[model samples]
Target: MRDVLRIEDLVLKFRGYTGVTEVLHGISLNIRAGERVALVGESGSGKSVTARIVLGQLQELRSAQVQGGLYFEEQDLNRLSRRQWHALRGTHMSMIFQDPTSSLNPVFTIGVQFTEVLRRRDPKLSKEAAAKRAGELLNSVSIHDHARVLNAYPFQLSGGMNQRVAIAMALANHPSLLIADEPGTALDVTVQAQTLHLMHDLVERTGTAVLFISHNLGVVREFADRIYVIYRGRIVEQGPTQAVFENPRHAYTRALMAAVPRITGGGVPEIQDMDGAFFDPLEVHGEDRP
Candidate 1:
């Protein structure tokens, strides 16, 4: 499988009045064609930031300092102009955000919003054609009543329903890459699982590579072929999901695995603080030294 996305020595920092805060520390990873890759960690682990960089969203911030290569199909994403990214974002690569409400406009009917998205790639597409295509995309995501969904406002739908609609819109054009950033975090566990499964099925059918970012190890384990464990902005472990889970090499990876609760066992065990022991640069392979 050829690599569709690659990041080498990626670093991100933000400048503030106090000083510069480094968020991502020389992160390196890749996603092969039609492969499912997961970036997992606790909240504030820079997973979201990495996703944003991949989607070319961080280029807008003047205070942000980004270094290293971000390649999509051997094209340097960091070098693309904003206009170029605008052209590529929806048609060639799309993103599903954590909050559906934030992604969907509340004032417009879903039909109107979806139509606009369709016309973004094809300016001459008629309203009727766009609606028909939108309905088909919605149906692909298992929303049977596409008519009701298209006519309804985002606020009128439940969180899960809105999320499904979001997924439909993101996959509407069959983008080669899908950047899903904590997409199921807002929904309940059952709904989240269902939504993730639906995404997996759709991606499999379309052969779209997925870059999934989440804090939930359980979801990552279930959805991703390969898992990258990141802590404090640096990747600590990367390999096949089963290998990392069965034989974790990093202390942080072991801690994260141990944190997952067992269904048929005693209460959740307290994770011992190793006095910042796992954060040592010497213990991890992907860390950049000063």
Candidate 2:
């Protein structure tokens, strides 16, 4: 399979009065066509930053300085013009954020928002065509009563429902790559599982690669084909999902694993001094593991 996305020595820095604080430290990874890859890390581990950069959303931040190479479909993203990037975003690459409340427009109805997104992808499409496509997209995500949803405002819908609608919008353009940043973080466990399963099925059927960013190791294990463990903005460990979970090489990775609830008998094992260990990037691969 061809590589749909590639990051080579990618770095992101935030400038402040103190100095430059590096958030993403020369991270490198690749996602092949139709693959599901998860980036697992703590809250400030740069997982979301990486996804934003991939979607061409980081250029707006004045404090942010992005360096190194980001390639999508053999085209260098870092070098793309603003117009080019805008055209590519949502059309070829899309993102689903952690919270749907802030992402969705409160004034607009779900139908309006969805149809607008569909029209953005296909401007010549008529209102009826857009509505029909929006309904199908909603149905594909297992949402029932499409007409009711279309007329309802974002605030009227539950968080889980809004998230499903958001997912439908993201997939509306049939993007080649979808970046989901803690997509179901605010949802209950059951809804999260259902949404994840729906997303997995949709991506599989459409052959859209996913770069999922989350702290949920269990979810990663279940959904991702390969896993990249990021710590302090660098990839500390990466491998096939089973290999990374079964034999975590880095102490940070092991610490994350230890934090997961143990269903067998005893609760999660006690992890000591995990905080300081992940503060700085650990060079486990020693320039060998790209």
> How far off is residue 81 in model 1, in Å?
1.2
Residue 158's lDDT within candidate 2 is 90
Compared with the true structure, what per-residue lDDT tens digits does model 1 show for residues 179-253?
A: 999998899999998899999999999999999998778888889999998989999889998898889887787
lDDT of 2 by residue, 42-140 (tens): 887888889888878887799999999999999988788889998888889999999977799998888788877877778898889988999999999
| RMSD from true fold, candidate 1 | 5.2
Q: Where is the poorest 10-residue window by lDDT in model 1?
A: 280-289
TM-score of each: 0.91, 0.91
How high is the CA lDDT of each candidate model?
A: 0.87, 0.86
Q: Count clashes in each candidate, considering only residues at least 3 apart in sequence or on different chains.
A: 0, 0
Question: lDDT (0-100) at residue 142 of candidate 1?
Answer: 82
Worst lDDT 10-window in candidate 2: 280-289
Superposition TM-score, candidate 2 onto the true structure: 0.91
Error of 1 at 154 (Å): 0.4
